[model samples]
Target: MSTIFGIPTPALYGQILIGLINGSFYALLSLGLAVIFGLLRVINFAHGAQYMLGAFVAYLLLNYLGINYWLALIVAPLVVGAVAVVIERTMLSRLYGVDHLYGLLLTFGLALILEGAFRHWFGAAGQPYAAPSQLSGGVNLGFMFLPIYRGWVVVASLVICIGTWLLIEKTQLGAYLRAATENATLVQAFGVNVPLLLTLTYGLGAALAAFAGVLAAPIYQVSPLMGTNLIIVVFAVVVVGGMGSILGAIITGYVLGILEGLTKVFYPEASSIVIFVIMAIVLLVRPAGLFGREE
Candidate 1:
């Protein structure tokens, strides 16, 4: 039996797969945070609440109505996006002219309110969501058995992440977004409808968070507090990755996730602090992040 680093190679590969899945979620969630920070200049504290909302929405859709997992994946994000847009159009829009602190506080309040509401109703208990029929099984790979759903998650998220990166890095639309972030008034003078753009950006960010939420629902319980903890870890990912570039954020997320998973295999005690420790090092070595340009 061959082994790597004193651990069985098979077990190492299995943990790597799990790491990839976790990394996928990290990538999606951090991408949203990066986009929001880049375009809006606001640290959206309500992002976690939106994540929780996505899981709950999918859960309710199944139990209350006849909505299945396939449709819920599409619907959950849209619904969460709509909510974000509404918040942007109403309350968030008013803060653009105010201090960034105000925006952060407002969003934090919203997060607490939403989380409290969900807890009040759901009683802090979690509900289970079944995996879709198409992705509920596993495949034998001779060396190991691969869970179909887990592989699907890793592949699907990778596609989505790469697709988003390409859209932002290569498209004309993304150019406008980048330009508007620097000088919104100038962009608006050209009749680009900057307000609409902001709303749409928030929607996209919320949709990203919701997508991660839906992906996780089948694996984890659909509980109000789920997002609370997840978002903190994701925030560390964003800090380490820097909120400057989409590609940077996505790449950093997956890498850090894998590192954390590997640490758990070798030294379980360090798994939790590894991310924060990396964050501290990144800040000291390159305050602008690996892919970020110095301001």
Candidate 2:
């Protein structure tokens, strides 16, 4: 068999595919975080709980009502988004003018409540969410066997990420969002409904996290604690990507995911800590992060 760097091509390709698949999740989750941070300046510690909620919602929908995955995909996000909207309208909104730390503390409390409730109800066991019938197979690529679902994940995530970026960077609505973040008081004076914008932005970020959870349901065990582990890693991703730049978060998330995957193949022990090491290096070199702008 052909080899690159003395590693079998199939083995190398397989690892790369794993990298890309993981990167897709990182990109989607971080994209949501970036959006909220860009607009509201909230750290959104509850993002992972929302993700776990998405998975649980999907599972509950399936088990209790015989609803399918596709329906859950849409419904779960809407439900989580609504919850997020309520959060913003009630608590987050009032904290907007206060110190950013308050928003963090409030959300962290909310996250604990949500996670505890889920664990109380569901216990620690993870439930399964089978892949949709259409995507439950693999294709033989020249170098290695490729899982269609995994490839589809990479393609779909890239499209979603780019589409979101364009919506925020190129569209008229995006222009308004960008403008609002810079000068909400001025934007409000201009009669743009800044309050509504803030509510919608938070909902959008929560919905994005839920969407990511749906995407991940089949690949990972659907469990209450799942989001807790990933959310911490994503924060690191945000720190490296530059909390100020939306595009930077997306790029750093995916790059780090792939790098982690590659490290798994070459040095399994380092895979766990590689992201933290990169975070340290980046912090030492560029305190604001690669895409972050100093205040």
Find the candidate with the highest lDDT and give its number.
2
Of candidate 2, the 10-residue stretch with the lowest lDDT total is 141-150
Tens digit of lDDT per residue, candidate 1, span 121-227? 98888888889999989998877779999888888789888987887778887877888988999999998988898999999999988888888899888999998
User: 150-210 in candidate 2: lDDT tens per residue?
Assistant: 8777887898899999999999889989999898889889889888998999999999899
The lDDT per prediction is: 0.88, 0.90
Q: In candidate 2, residue 48 scores what lDDT?
A: 95
**TM-score top scorer:** 2
- Worst ten-residue run, lDDT, model 1? 9-18
Per-residue error for 258 in candidate 2, Å, reads 0.3
lDDT of 2 at 236: 90
